[model samples]
Target chain A: MSTDTPANSESALSPEEVAELRSRVDELETELSTLRTEMDDDSKKMVIIATKGTLDMAYPPLILASTAAAFGYDVTVFHTFWGLEILHEENSKDLKLSSVGNPNLPVPNAIAALPGMDRMTTRMMRGKIEDNDVASVEELVRTSLDSGVDLQACQMTIDLLGYDEDDFYEGVTTGVGAASAFQEMVDADIQLLV
Target chain B: MSTETTETLDVKGQNCPMPVIKTKGAFDELADGETLEVVATDAGSVSDIAGWADSTDGAELLDQTEASEDGETVYKHYIRKAE
Candidate 1:
């Protein structure tokens, strides 16, 4: 901003003063336009921390990420601990649903602990998903990837679990630390933990 | 009040996120100020589409209506690209 001031008197003004005022107005206009451009460049972002790797738990983060991306939001999902299994090329499809200790499962805990019960529960859940026309975990993962959602795997978890980086699906940002993921979460308009 | 639809998208039988996802793809192909009409069977789309349009830039939700076709309920949404 310029410090120059216009005289309040009803007297005629000098040409130099008028020119200076006009230039000052031009500078302010330029600054206003720049500010507007910067505001327009800022896009909404969403971040989710996926801590559960169960078959049913994986759907929430993936669904939210894909949907947010569809709404034109920049989305990122940080997979840590057991959640890293979602990015594993083979484990993604092999995820199992545990019926034991889950009140939602009508079966008794003793029965749920029987041999092959987990497999049976997983199969039943898959059937329910198919009957409802809902998307499978595989489909949702593929959709998230296709929609450009960032799937970041925690590097510390991978090292602790003794998992190979090459086992993850293509396009996954493996080896991301907590600090990097937190940076994204801080900038995101929405953050969730599942 | 005199706006006309510029494109139509059919997402019947699709579940959560698919209807919204497909709508996004269709909207991308539409020109500015153009309108898109989406037909869906997912009951959840009523709220999903509304929420999506509310959050998305350049998207203006015009209206949403419900109807029954061949013994099945259907939802239709009209949105405009206002950017």
Candidate 2:
């Protein structure tokens, strides 16, 4: 008896062997595709909610949201109450410089004696933030918008405060109520009230 | 039962969201079937880290321990990587 292998012999490979090899390749391809899709989805799923406003309270939320977005999270800053003032394009100008008797303002007494305190405080805060290697509230807002983070203002507060839509900075999404804001928070993987 | 492997991430002194952000990044870098241990000094991190882990499916939190360090409370989380 002679034992020899032929190059053109299709029968050399049994039908089961061919089928198993093809199935394994198909399975591997499916798994690879699924993994790629999952990673892509994970990258897109990062979400954050930030609330900004009120003297010292204004910076944390905005800064955190912006930095989070910079780290690739889809972020949203919900500006309500005193927080809405930070969204005003002319917040440093038209807004009052006095913290005295401002119920919403944090550290109201601490800023009460500084002349032209509101403006001076804003500038000083901006400088200090820069000095600390942190982004300014305005820059953070801008960066948040640029990074595709939602910048939502509170509509009810806007109406209550008599602020027109035009008073807000560019790229801000029009006012949304608390219910809507809560819905947003619910969808977010991370939410901050600062 | 075999002993499970673990990874650690130190995010002390960082503020809110940073610890969460870094933890997420560490999770992303981990291989499937691994676990991550995160230590953070931020007060908010206790809730934030737990919330993040719970929101995602497959991820398992093995442990969460709080300890006082130099007058500040620190949170330590042990999370298993889920596919």
Candidate 3:
């Protein structure tokens, strides 16, 4: 009948303590597994579709894709339609901003009506973005390349539009047809049309 | 002196993951136990930096400071290299 008997018992742990200890062991096991997983490459995949050529519309997709790549995720950018223009190295340098036919573009009415409106619109847009401290489309392209974002131009669109590889910026991946692009889209975890 | 080194990257004008991406590249070039300092302008970067440091294991966020520059708020982060 000594109190030492109870204190020295093999089953000294109370039910609450046993439960808490089990929970702690589980947590430690989870943390170890998470650490191992982080060390492993099980990277995420993201796909972005760039179908518009306007400066405002161009940066978002590239920026997002590059940013995702920086975070250890594989990113692919599919350029189709007007978006393919951004990949054109030669034309990209002189790509004009168009406000006339672009409905989604935000432009002042008077400026949108000017002669050679596209050039004027481009200047206005560039100025506005600069004023707000945003990077230019060219800068975005450079960043995209530096970040290793896979840039794929639509071959069907390129041929249909009479474009050659020389027209696209450096670091662009091989031009793929529509079916390839569709396959890529289906394989991605995230699909964004920007 | 333990010879531990720390580097700082200023990406105040950069938005989104530029700060984080560039920081990752910088971290890659450092030896284990080195440190990195990152300054970012993207509002989301505050949380992103902390999250990246936590998830990367060997890395730990030592400090984070937010300051207003030219009417924009920029975040400064100090990360220790852990691996």
Q: Which stretches of candidate 3 lie above 4 Å from their native place?
A: A1-41, A100-111, B1-5, B41-44, B51-59, B68-74
* Model 3 score (lDDT): 0.78
Provide the clash count, candidate 2: 1
Regions of model 2 farther than 4 Å from truth: A1-52, A92-127, A130-133, B1-83
lDDT of 1 by residue, A1-194 (tens): 55577655777677899999999999999999999997897788999999998899989999999998998889999999999989888899888999998989989999999999999999999888888778877788888999999999999999998999998888899869989988998988899999
Alpha-carbon local distance difference test for all models = 0.91, 0.70, 0.78
Put down candidate 3 lDDT per residue, A93-174, tens digits, no spaces. Answer: 5567668766766767666777887886788776877675676667768778877888999887888888888778888876
Per-candidate TM-scores read 0.82, 0.46, 0.72
In the predicted model 1, the residue pairs found to clash are: none
- Residue A99 in model 2: lDDT: 65
* lDDT, candidate 2, A18-73, per-residue tens: 89999999999999999898667764323333343555666666656655664566
Q: Give per-residue lDDT, candidate 3, residue A80.
A: 89
For model 1, the stretches where C-alpha displacement exceeds 4 angstroms are A1-41, B1-3
Best by lDDT: 1
Per DockQ, what order, best first?
1, 3, 2
Candidate 1 local accuracy as lDDT?
0.91
